[model samples]
Target: MKIFKERHFFRLVIVLLLVSMASCNKKKNSYTAVSELDKKTFASTQLIPDDHFLGDASCKTCHAKEHDYWQGSHHDKAMQVATDSTVLGNFNGIEYKSQGVKSRFYKEGSAYFVNTEGPDGKYHDYKIEYTFGVTPLQQYIVKFPNGRFQCLRTAWDTKKHKWFDLYPDFKVVHSEWLHWSRGGLNWNNMCADCHSTNVRKNYDEATHGYDTKYALINVNCEACHGPGKDHVEAARSLGKDYKGNGDLKMTSQTKPKALVDACARCHMRREQISEYYNFEGSMLDHYFPQLIVENVYYPDGQILDEDYVYGSFVQSKMYHNDVTCTNCHDPHSLKLKFEGNKLCAQCHVPETYDTPKHHFHPTGTESSKCINCHMAGRYYMGNDFRRDHSFRIPRPDQSLKYDTPNACVQCHKDKDNQWAWEAYVKLYGKPKHKHFSDLLAPGLRGEAGGLNHLLELAKDTIYPEIARASAVNVMTNYADPQVIDNLLHFLKDESPLVRGASLDVLGEINAADYVNYLLPLLEDEKRSVRVKAFFALGSLDEALIPEPYKAVYKKVKKEFETNLKVTSDFVGGKVKQGNYYLKQGKLLDAIASYEAALEIDNTNNIARTNLANLYYRNGDFANAEQAFKTIITQEPEYGQTYYSYGLLLAELNRVEDAIVQMELAIKYMPDNIRPYYNLSLLYDKANQLNKAESTALKGFKKSPQDESMLYILAYIYSKNNEVEKAKNIAKRLVDLYPNNSNYRAFYNQLNAVQ
Candidate 1:
């Protein structure tokens, strides 16, 4: 998976380099033209007809069995107005205390209420508006003015039958957006889209309000199929004589891709293009799924955060074999097609896979369950346990080597990875096939041969698009010529994921010379692709864009702006807007965007950190310092904040204070080599030879292949009268960069020294 490294670290390093040396135009002619800009043919744009959503009720007459099966299912009961029957929580004036806050859930005259601290940190009697989810846990939703509905942090565990806090350990302040009264926990913006059918978040960015609308209160028949108006019309015209296919455009068993797209619309963590989603065309045209990035997924593509199922399922061999969501899951009831191991037996021979000999465990135990080894479960939302849909084998060997979590070790807490590894080989023997994680884990961490392996993986068509995209993104850390070439090549990849991820890397590199290459993507079929291209072109000079591409850029730019505004109700959207404005050199607009994000979510560290950097960019040092100080006070362990603050302090000539911050950054981020390089330089400037030499040597030890670090270490060693060490380091640099005369001359001089 692509690791989201701290951008400030790169900014610091780049600032130290001469601008001309890092100029994109230096080798512009070296790249060959792949092809002329060809306008892509997109899927036909179709809007839902008026009164299109007939809801699940309309399907009852003909599809009685399907309709009956859907009733009282998880999807059917996803959202419900709080009532005597629907509510599962205790509402008898029971007070629950968590994180020093006392909340009382009670009932009065058929009304359900919760007395809890609201946005202002004062107790308020908030009426329970709705019940969200019907599973291991169920949360209550409270409505506020301006069309906002927030899900309570405390939910009733249906299994345990007790109220529990989702974030039991964190003391969330009332002013924080995560405190349930704010945007982070807002049901209308975040949860409503997935929970209901045909939901529209009519957000007004100007007013910061949502006039949300929905066709159905819960997931229904039309949610899986397209809007039913056209189908209904065709069926009525036939009048009980419809013997043919009825020529309905709605997704069905015939269209596997469309069906998966329909399921992924809600099942994936994605950014939606419009208020409405359809079961036609590419899902990428309307929504951009979250890539296998850090925090969201482990480097080995295991579930880390609440990714739902789409991302993991797409990586599985079953998906490549054209296994749609409906293959395993019953579409209407949202349950497995068969009980227990029977699901696997449908695909694999029962004699080979469903026996004790294959499973290596006694029959009828949890360990013998197919899901226990292949589809490992992770506990989420305090009580819910969601299994990984990737269906990968347990690799305890990888767990030991790469420090990645393994299903075997996860279940066998009393046993170590070595024991699990030995047991695995003893039972099933060594792995016969290479997994994507083997390359991905090392590539993402910048370990030995990472750059080449990632580049190869990105270009390999056989791997999943998500893994390939991740490989392209991991190339960003290397900043090599081959990385740039590979990234540009991926822009033309068939999958939208690869193309979009390539654009992300392009934006970071500021590839001004690739303006022509990026311009054509503005008119790409997918909205996600177009949006990524627009952002990638943020660094390109507007005037330099050819006249033919100007109109297209303007249209896509507006689309991108509208996309940002659609999610402006959340802090993340504001941060994206801030980044866009900042890239476009709209200082005031960027400042306003960041400030607005902070206003919505007071404890948003990312927004605060970026705001501080912007203040420093605008030469407002006092505010920058204050912002950094606030972050330090709020999150002392955050290494990126300290690293950025150290850079800011150094820029302002507070060398002594900067050194302290740099030390803290290193203390928090030991693996990062930037702090060591800068700290060594700082110590040298302060005339502390021993500290400078030691720090330089430490950086060199950490990154032996890093040319800059090697040069610094060589210089430091020479200064400290360590001629042999200097010669050895300089010789390695010369060997690495044989064409560079400076390195060769430096090596010769060091070698000649006594």
Candidate 2:
């Protein structure tokens, strides 16, 4: 395997207790004792059965100040009916065109409508059911059949007061995934959970329709605080001096992590484990936060995707020191507590970070602003720019080596990384950041002890848990026994992210020997941990599971089924469903699942890829070839299709064709070693001795301990009359694997030849 930390729960629990004590002292007169008040409304994490969501209007009576501040905030305007007052776009029969799509915005009898390309590849009038978001841009929603609400690819630039295409560069046909009418634009699946309060996506698996409901049409007081009926009733019945809050989660009453976790429920690129927000347990219980991985994040841990904030925030010194969303942003208004450098000066000394000597730029300039340097951001949703919350200092040195973006180069686009480095060092001295970037950048390339270097990063407690989890995620590339052993140590890791990640990698490698080691996690305190355990072990043969573990497995299997159900609408989820079926010897079911996924979106290459793989497995080589060909036609650059097609060709003894396909695979997936290894054998089979030696040697440079590559290289050298070179390699093979009789024979044979 080119594959694969510390518990922080106790420390957090202590912090929570201390913060709770301090909270009571901080608001002694207004609220009752935290314990006394909480007992009646909350039984552990669950609210009383009678409790219901009391809408935002009910909250205004008691929290007038908060309500006033929140009235026009992003949360309040997140979603709304397309009425004249609520709609921000100039929908006056204006036609906007992009990517061969001509969309017209207009109104018909007090109803907002868009004459745009829909699912049928023809123009149709779609009534704008709702407007999504408010500032920089606003997307219109059109309710389609099967209870699907699709967000329009045509959006209004609220600031520029003009219409624009979200993806201007690409041509989208009706059959493609990114088409406005497809599942990619689905509001019920992607947008609703975050935008509304108390949302329940009642999706029918059989019908493929949704009966989505929300207590509030937009994010409101109860959205973050949970259902407010308990709080409202308690305040009304128990009076101002009452000991407890009505079991409603007030951000003011909670500690920083709790408050941040509440906000992170929506403000994260997380995997949804449950259908609705339950207002229970830790953030991990409700959602699994995205680990900092390639594509999503740069090697230096800067945001490269729409990570929301929690993924980046958790990796920051601020989050490590218990700073939270409300520390900089007002909980109610969702605006900065202070403008410019003042916000940073809340903890940092103003003279140290805010002065010209430190920043080296003129005051009030974009370069001089603290956020411009420390919180480098990129535009998302076309124009809505979101800064990274990791609070890292600019490291142009890393940028020079790693190609990661730095604030210095972001503003001074004309300047190269060298210029940025020189300027930075001249002002601030050599940057001494002890963060994991140094370890991670090279680790990603698997250079200089590769997986070992990553293991060191994962084990080192100084790095954030999210970073550690990312290290675990990347370990999938390296599949070594030693790496698997090192990874097993994390099964009992303190953080759920770390623990869940351990299960994920172990399952990927199919470390069946460690399945016993993973059973305890099935009963873990966190829902994410338990869910991961089920996912890892769910497809196993029942005989592999010990009798002692069966009862727990039986219980978790139900949760596992629910897990499948909740995500069945997703292409990734369907891929997972197919895998489970394949593992359980249910071939037809697996094929059906993958085929159904393609029905949802024909452009879903993963589903199509899985179908091709199944076809190959079932001796339907012609069908498999056709499937791979179709995929290559649809996505010419997709490397996996070429690699898979090469394997099928090799299996069918089409060596010349296989060689061509494998060479293409190497071209597209350069980092993947399997292609190089396979191509080397193909050359040897064709009696191309020099080409075989060259290919195997190149692959050996990447994975030095690869036995097969080494053996092939030795055989090629020996055949080509390079006896001394062959002997040297044979000696290494014997030294590395002394127990292998073939290696011993090869070494002796080489010695006799020399």
Candidate 3:
């Protein structure tokens, strides 16, 4: 039996279920009633004099129906004060143990307290300031000095009614930034913007603190419908002297795309651009949605991590077909409009879809469900089974070939992928080779036939923009002329995502080559496109850029810089700022930024590694060596760190030490080709022909089409008198790149020699 195994792609699954919890209430059309169980655990909306934020209470007086429906919703109880009524967990001096650490949850008088291992790696009695989220799981937020609220590692499983560790697989030490007590889990920076309305993350970069303020404690009507001040004023002037139509700045956006973008501000896996923004413009203006890439998503665009919904939904046919989050789900109550097959029948014809012929399962069985086949669920946070929003069809054939999860075998725990694939073929006939997954899988793996397939997928307007952009992103690693040409064309694509992704790819390439090409993008309509254009231009030599374009660059560059500043309190933002500075050739500023990131979260390995690389690049060998050593000692499993350290050692003329580090890098990341190529070259330079040949051949086994590895292997084989092997490699290389003069010349030379 081929049971599905979770990969190590997501180091930590921080599943923040932005949407409402699952509902069993069989409401047909009317809004799901909010009972006593549904009362929003957090504070409700109230009118404030100066502030634009009118709490749920303010709206309830007029829009009582919406208020009642939204009362006990996920947004309503996103976070609340840890009180007798609010605290869901058993805090009656109960002890929960995991990984040699014991935490006691107890209540003193009316206050909830937890005696747990803190940031200092010692047990401390920390007051539960707030209860963050309630559903399959509920986490407690503990306030620290420096105005930080961190979600505790241990969470209460609401469904199971038991305590469970968020990171059950590993014992995260207190000192690590990923530890519950650190800034990585800080509520103000990570969770507050989405959970609350009119949130201003007043993060002080100089003070290294947050004076974070929010209008409403929970996501109220104004959160989605935009600020209610103008709407409320318009309502108040209803019978007074109101004009033709009250110019209410409400986001009553009926357009499917616009409405989704409004919701995406919270639901998307994205980066913040502005401190506070209403639903007035594009989501790309205020936040940059992360492209569907590895670590964040499966190669087939499945939700590999806790990528809420928007990222996956944007790639689905549903989003492209004008279907949105509100189509199936109630906009206010955030529950399904119908139950089971009836929900699918809302749009799809019941006779055509919700039957055994369509579902290919026994009627009324769990496998017969529409969601089971189309929207497979994956368990995150121990018990939270979130469904994949991509809504892809069951493709067990793809699963068998690519080792990705398929809905067919997800429920059939005792069946192998081959069994599922054969059954699917028998029932549905051979699946069409039309899915974006077919192209994306090869593109992500860097396998043969990827270039043409990916290029076609990218240019095809029929496919989802997110999927097309993802294709462009994966094609970035390839140096094909068509790849660059297609990317250049995509720079002018109508979709902001495509343009932004193309710019990201071109920026990594020779930025000077596309300097004039990306100049017009500085004034691009989308903020994401404009910022990416600025980034691409910023990569070039300042003097090489035209005078007229420099002004455009400066204006957009300020926006980019301000975006970084707005999020500088977090480790990720600081690291990004450091990278930006590094690209700008400000080594000291880059170093300072990285150092600042470490100050905020001491266990930020990316910052540490980047700092080490900078030190090495700047010729500070001593510090670089120390930094690399610390990283290796602390995070030995991180292959990239070892690979970087190997390069540093090589530069220092410590070839033997470099070789060892490179070998370790290969051990951890076998699929990585850089270490193999570099290690082989090092071996050849050291006159170790046997080791060089072995290393190159191993790399060839993993990535047979890798031109660099093939060249090195051919060279080593020819020098070692393995003429036949050298000629075979030469022939393959020439066949792969027929037009390449170098490959042809090398092949001819090898043939002549033979």
TM-scores, each model vs. reference: 0.89, 0.88, 0.87
All candidates in order of lDDT, best leading: 1, 2, 3
**For residues 163-272, what per-residue lDDT tens digits would candidate 2 score against the true structure?**
88776776778887667787777888777878887666677878889998777889888777766554555566757675664355755768888777878777877666
Which parts of model 1 have CA positions greater than 4 angstroms off?
A: 1-50, 243-251, 278-280, 541-544, 547-551, 697-710, 713-736, 741-754
Candidate 1 residue 547 Cα shift, in angstroms, is 4.8
What digit string (tens of lDDT, one per residue) describes model 1 on residues 334-412? 7889988888888899888878989878888888889989999788778888899998998998888777778888888
| lDDT by residue for model 3 (679-712), tens | 9988987889999999999998988888888898
Clashes of 3: 4
Among all windows of 10 consecutive residues in model 1, the one with the lowest summed lDDT is 9-18
Report the Cα lDDT for candidate 1. 0.77
How should the candidates be ordered by TM-score, best one leading?
1, 2, 3
In model 2, where is the ten-residue run with the lowest total lDDT? 1-10
Two-way lDDT contest, 1 vs 3, winner: 1
RMSD, one per candidate, in order:
9.2, 6.4, 8.5
Residue 37 in candidate 1, Cα distance off native in Å:
17
Question: Which lDDT value does model 2 have at 587?
Answer: 86
Evaluated at residue 470, the lDDT of candidate 1 is 85
* CA deviation > 4 Å runs, candidate 3: 1-50, 240-253, 540-554, 666-677, 680-754
Whole-model lDDT per candidate: 0.77, 0.76, 0.76
